[model samples]
Target: MIDIDIRPAVPADAGAVLDFWKTAAEGTSISDDVAGVTRLVQRDPGALLLAESDGVLVGTVIAGWDGWRASLYRLAVHPSRRRQGLSRALLDAAEERFVALGGRRGDAMVLEANEPAHHAWAAAGYRREDHWRRWTKPLA
Candidate 1:
């Protein structure tokens, strides 16, 4: 296994991140584009974390802290790199960031159809909130 390096993403990484997500992530979001990601990096520089093996992107996770809540999103690993502890590394960095920010709890948005993600999140000590329903409105 190659050594993995986890770090915060930069504006220049937006394109590569979008492309990586297309192959590694289970689903797409409206804000998965380059512009959206660039905005994220510019706004909250440490929120978007990237994992690289020999400088090639292998994993990504968004650990967003908005003063009150710590929300996680886009937790993805390269299909070829799955089950190799890449996700765990990313989550560790994310949770550490939250802890440093005085965050009490963290929430993740996982797609219901992505069973693989469900298991991973569960293994990481996250439980599914079946009683809650997600509501969204597209601003675009």
Candidate 2:
């Protein structure tokens, strides 16, 4: 595992985080812009986990807990930083946070087309549930 600074993202980090996701993340989502990120940090404060090394943004994961469910999203690592243990560290931090907050299961929203991400998630003890399908409707 390489040395990293894992911490929750603050409101000030919204822009950098959105920029980071452009290169690090696999796909796009509706709530991936500055306003959405700022709202997330303001609403939960601790949901967005960021990993920095040498004062640079290297990775991120959103460990969202809505007081009932643990939802993981946007698990991303810098292209140059992949295959290391950053994902593991971020996940460990997220999982620990969930457990501490009375969460039982930590669920992730993984893209089906992202095969590389599949290996990483599986390596972290996350499994896909074929029985469950996500249904979403954009409010906007």
Candidate 3:
């Protein structure tokens, strides 16, 4: 097992997390901003999980539970840390969180074009629900 610390992100980590995402994560969303991330941490302290190795952030995943659903987003691992057990470690932590909170099922938001991520998610026991489609509208 990798000797790393897996914990919830704090308020001060917002900016650094955003910077990390730019390099490690694929694609982006409006909530990718520091301000938005700060708000998320402020609102739900345990939702954002960060993986640190040797005191440096290497991966992240949002295990959001809002009473009704367990939703995941922003699952990213650093390039140098790829092919290791970090992703599984993170997902295991996230799933444990969901079970602790009485979450019946967990769903992830994966980009359609991210083939590598498809393999990872599949390896993690997540399957594609082709019958479902995500609908979004920006609230500007």
Candidate 4:
């Protein structure tokens, strides 16, 4: 495991964040749009936690609090950095941020087919709360 550091993301980190997201393994929902990440960071820098290994952005997780509830989203650890404590550290920081903002409970949505993510979340003290079926409506 390389030396890892977790911290809130700033607008300057957007480029690195988008690069990592795009190069991540297939089947990840990480966005490749630098502009989108920049906007997100500008709006809520505290919600974006980034993990760095030797000055490289290896992981990212977004913790969004909407007054009443907090949701963890877009957690991605670099393929090379797997099995290290980076993900756990990112999650811990995210949860701490949530708690500081008066979040009483938290939630995460992991794809049912993504076993590794599901296991990681479970290991980090999350459990299946309910089954949700998705219905997508495309706008033209």
User: Which sequence of candidate numbers ranks them by TM-score, best first?
Assistant: 2, 3, 1, 4
Estimate the TM-score for candidate 3: 0.98
Instruction: Rank the candidate models, highest lDDT first.
Output: 2, 1, 3, 4
C-alpha lDDT score of every prediction, in listed order:
0.94, 0.96, 0.94, 0.80
Superposed Cα deviation of residue 85, candidate 4 (Å): 1.3
- Estimate the overall C-alpha local distance difference test score of candidate 1: 0.94
lDDT of 4 by residue, 1-140 (tens): 45888888888887777777777533544344677677777777698898887788889888988788788887889988888877788888899998899998878867778888988888899898676665667453
Model 2 clash pairs are none
How far is each candidate from the true structure, as Cα RMSD in Å?
Answer: 1.0, 0.6, 0.7, 2.4
- Each prediction's TM-score versus the true structure: 0.97, 0.98, 0.98, 0.85
Residue 119, model 3: Cα distance from true site in angstroms = 0.5
- Candidate 3 lDDT, 4-57, residue by residue in tens: 899999989999999999999999998878789998998878889999999999
TM-score of 4: 0.85
Clashing pairs in 3: none
Where in model 1 is the C-alpha error above 4 Å?
Answer: none
Error of 2 at 48 (Å): 0.2
* Residue pairs in candidate 4 whose N, alpha carbon or C atoms collide under 3 angstroms: none
